[model samples]
Target chain A: MDDARLAELYERYGFLVHRRCLQLVRRPEDAEDALQETFLRVKRYGPPRDGGATLAWLYTVAARCCFDLMEKRGREPVAEESQLAALEERGDGSTEDADRRALLGAALRTLDGKTRTIGVLHYLDGYTQDEVAAQTGFSRKTVGKKLKTFEDRIRQLFAGRSHEARR
Target chain B: MTAPLPPSPRGPECPPAAVLEALSAGEPTPDATRAHVQACAACGAQLEALTTGRDAFLRARPADRFLRQLERREAAAPSPWRRLFPVLAAVVPVLVLVLVLGPRLTGDGPGVTWKGEAFRVVVSRAGAEAVPLAQDSAVKEGDRLRFAYESPEAGHLLVLELDGRGGATVFHPFEGTASAPLAAGQRDFLPGSVELDDAPGTEWLFAVFSPRPLQAAPLLARLREQAGRAEPTLTCDGCRVSSLRLRKAP
Candidate 1:
């Protein structure tokens, strides 16, 4: 992609990549590395023609890079809750922060590729459930239900955290 | 980021999750989501909290500093080699003359005669060829002499001089490819080469073709006029130096 397009992506969706990676990796610095590496890869190989698919392609690349980093770390293909809580406490980045991220990361790993990918594109990346459906070849109802279920699970995760974190 | 409301037959029920979702990606919330957020203290607090984190991360690396570092990288690249034309013109004639006369290094003895049309060079054995050539080669101190050559027959004889100078001396009679060792200078020759140390000065003479009794008289006269009072210099102008003579025929 040209620098203008790359810069536009940086300005528009840069955070989703960072936050999505933070959800997977749990460390801010490592997540930053994974995101930066992902963008750099996008700069190199790049998405072709379809501007509409650009975000999804970039998201896919970022997702792959984050997974590669997690694999390299040899942790279960997901970030843990307590670690997510620490990142959230360190960040103060809203209630939708760390453990919610960890729970999402863990839920995604448990899902089949099609369902998991749809869930990530819908929730973590903020793509509409329809958009997630388009990217993952899933039906809209399937994406909608998956998202609602994911949201319920996130609520459960936070509720559990409130009890555990209560000293 | 706007919260999508619960499915409403009459209107939308904006959910905090959808609003927070939009906000997470740094986009503005949908109007319905904003109305929902305005009514909900929890959604408002979450917005305020996430925005604070976003703002802190935005300034982590200033654009000015990043651009400055890029400028430094570009500035570090070496300038395209510029061989000043005048020195080049001067070096050309001398190189041609040396190539024409077959460049007599005359050993390391007291006599090192470099014979040419306009001037004759007889060097005193007292100095190193590098020292004196560095002092006299066409380039000024710190400048380099780039030598170009094409070898003909065995034992290549290339004239070493500055660049456009090669282009210049074609006005004179010079020959040989400096691609290999001439024993005269153990170093300095590439597909091209540049003088490492100093400019070779006044001692060099660029030879020209004299056609008094032969056929090229008119050409030499025009060339001599161009040469004027200036010492013989080499040029890359297209001409064969061996065909050009320095001495006028009787």
Candidate 2:
């Protein structure tokens, strides 16, 4: 993309990308770095061709950048307590939502990249399964299957954490 | 049988965050999504949060600064051909020499006299248009200042301030231990602004541009020693330094 178009893109969507990075990394400095890296990737590969899904596309890119930064620092993804609390508050006040929200970062670490991306799109961003499928270019069945796997992994993680806490 | 996925915490009628973001950006969205976002309190709050967060981000790290950082990062990486051709590596120094010396030889560029490094300070008072500060201009305690720099090469930059009461502080990167990366050949304003404190004295703003990252700790240490000097100078080998003096009044 040319400079003007790129500037316009940054002006319009940079906040969403920065917010996504902040959610994943939970550090202002690291989020800024990830935000820069996301735009650099955009400058290299160009924005997604699908105009409608641009924010979703940027979110995925920012998430990948945040994950890369976390890996580079040799640290596991750790959700801030405030973020987890916000997640719980936003959800229906159920134990399942609480468990899922509390263990989300750990559960996401345990899953593969594609599944984690799918999970974030559906659970975190509140995209419907159909919307997730459209954004990811996957069939609805595959999106459902991946989301199911993600949910199972979260449960497994919660069980393991509970077992450890009980011990 | 595969278990059904959990329903979204956001209601079924609520649009995705992406859709909300797009709507916030004034992009075209379906009427149904717009109506739903307007009617749903949760969705409305989400949209408002997005807007507030965006406004904060723009105020802190404006688009120009973000773009400059992007350009610097892109310029810092070597191209595939540069890696593949060892012979081409020899040509780079010659190219640098031409870029550094060519402007002086022709006297064609506006910054030819400054040796390709320029530092400018723009000051904004309450409800007034910002104007670039002339050398040793008078400023007030409540005045806000933004910095801009131009360089002949891509490098790391540190903007430091030496206040009248013998205090030295890093002005750019606001709170970092190292110099921020700067793009070459553009006179771009740095991210964020600095508001003058209630210190009444002559303050010196220094822009240190170097090809390699410089640690702020050592630089500040040296500046601290020289803070009381009538004219402070720092020794940074192979780095260009530009200084702006301001008389800060109470």
Candidate 3:
């Protein structure tokens, strides 16, 4: 956690951390704050002891910081219209991707910290269940169950939104 | 039974974004993953996007500038004392006044005895032997420095620096808002070393040791306020402050 190592880590991964923060918070300023906070925590608690991917470890920390900031501010994750439109335009066929992308923030808020992290690693970051298990120190079964919970919650959110639209 | 969840958009053959990001950063990646990324257009495009995004982010917010912003934000964050002020005012007015105003009213209250070399600093320069720094040692910019301390009793410690530019920064447990715990007796070089910044003139390094952890933000503020003095010190009731002065040429 010395200054030299920290500076090196920041140089290497700061952008990835910032991008993760920005993805979650959707505000440049807040992302910057979370990015700093992420590094601060890294300084406080050093890096992962196990020989996992440093970038994966950083992404989890950045996501947690973003979620904490959002909760502290008592604000919903800002879903910009432009971002939604981009997702919509990039959709393969169904609006599933767009809906999943848009509802992820709200759904994530409803989850416990561990489940949320697991969900983000698996769905958002595209980590496989085994990779998520390795990073999280959870068994493959636990990862699968947590992912099921996350998917169920996402479905509930999408269902609620659909009902609202129909109404 | 509930329907199975949709598969990840990355597809079955593609590697995860984390793998791609690691590849983009030039970190070690599996040969299979690297070959897949190289052969697969989608994976290659994703890696390209990651690289492009990283470049854009670094361009927008360089490390030095971002670090400065972080320092400012840390300085500006509200301390625990500030958050408790209203409660202290309502509940214990006399105690609050004594704690708040007593030190300022009295000319620099009781000073702790310098318990026989409780703190130490070691400097390492490229192609040079590592040397332990004494009081008023000559140091140059870019000399990496490490710190150690010897304490009779276990306590919380903060190693703070007042640079030539009157800027205060935490050295040990770098960039934290509070002191880190220290074990009793002699402890050798702390975990990390800090390279001296380009700021020229006299730099003061202080090791503030206390029975309890002290908030670094308030101490940093005090150091900034007293930067004009020959030596800046902290006023903690149960805290001992050891200082090392280093002369830096402009």
Candidate 4:
């Protein structure tokens, strides 16, 4: 996309990209940083396609940017860990919902960069399987396979964590 | 003399992804595909995966307020003129002035104003009336407590009850999901009353408000060990912590 087009894309999908970033990083400033970084990368390297494909492509880029930021922060995202620990201390392990989120976050960390991006786009960002496949250059079959694999792994992780909490 | 058919798109097997998608969307899977999934371990696993992923999706929410904050950041991003064109040097002083004076004028410095009054942890018992807690209010073990709050804007709320001796427990998000949503300008309470456990002393209660959900486990563990020495009030990015003190009845 050209400069005018990039500007237009930014205006049209700014919130979309930002939303994905926030879901991953959970910090407003970090989310903003990820948003700026994603667009900057887009501006530097042209988008994968035009029209509706662009949104999927953008979602993929935003997911990667957010994960990259998470990776750069090391093991767990600092803000999320800090906040999660704060909340967890206030109770025993009976908070099943919070544990599930913690479990999901931990499970996500186990995925490779590409798989994590795909999962975030499809699951958290609510992209359709076709859209994820289109953005990631995977066949719909492969996307389906990967998503299934992700689910199994996350469930296992959640189970282990819950078991540990019970112990 | 019949036209040859193009290759079959369905082939001998159904596309596992399409079937999983349909299943996740709550649509009926093709009968043949469902039968195939039941018999094929790989397809069955895929279906299970889709189920787990959809569950996560149901729990997840877009960080709307934070996304808007990012848009604001984009709008306020440094203009190209400031970076590319030296000819606009005259605008530099004004930019500098705004940066230097804005925080001071707006009270946007490090301090975060805690809105303790916005939330109340009312305590009562089976035969008694409920009253908003005041600092040092005496309460015995088994006193039932419920939280009531008014949020200035839609946000996530986390309540932590800190035993003055250094233990903390979460109270607001009673269900224990990532965070609980509180609508702006409305008084809300936990769906049920929480009975005070055996931990008895001058306990500190903290109510944390954030514009979006937060994963706060790490901080909770840290505070559990250090809460006794920590100050009653604390602040973090996008979150404001408010406090109340209560004493266990002697």
Clashes of each: 51, 0, 0, 22
Per-prediction DockQ scores?
Answer: 0.05, 0.21, 0.21, 0.02
CAPRI quality of model 3? incorrect
For residues B113-134, what per-residue lDDT tens digits would candidate 4 score against the true structure? 3645887778888787888787
Superposed model 3: Cα runs more than 4 Å off: A1-4, A43-52, A86-96, A130-142, A159-167, B1-7, B94-250
Candidate of highest DockQ: 2
Better model by TM-score, 2 or 3?
Answer: 3
Candidates' chain B TM-scores in the order shown: 0.20, 0.54, 0.55, 0.53
lDDT of 3 by residue, B8-64 (tens): 567678887667777887889889988898899888887777778788878877877
Q: Candidate 2 chain B: minimum summed lDDT over ten consecutive residues — where?
A: B108-117
- Alpha-carbon local distance difference test for all models: 0.47, 0.76, 0.78, 0.62
Docking class of 1: incorrect
User: Candidate 4: lDDT over CA atoms?
Assistant: 0.62
Candidate structures ordered by TM-score, highest first:
3, 2, 1, 4
Candidate 2 structure quality by residue, lDDT tens digits, B1-250: 2233465556778886667777877778999998998999988887787788778978888888888999898898799987868877788889898867865575432332233338888999989999989778999888999988888789998889889988888888785789999998867788789998988889988888888998999879988988778878665665777778889876
- Displacement of residue A55 (Cα, Å) in model 1 is 5.8
Error of 3 at B111 (Å): 31
What ranking of all candidate models by lDDT puts the best one first? Answer: 3, 2, 4, 1
Summarize candidate 1's per-residue lDDT along A3-115 as a digit string, tens digits: 66666666555665666677666667677777777766766677444634444555677778877776677654345555645554212234445435555655565456766
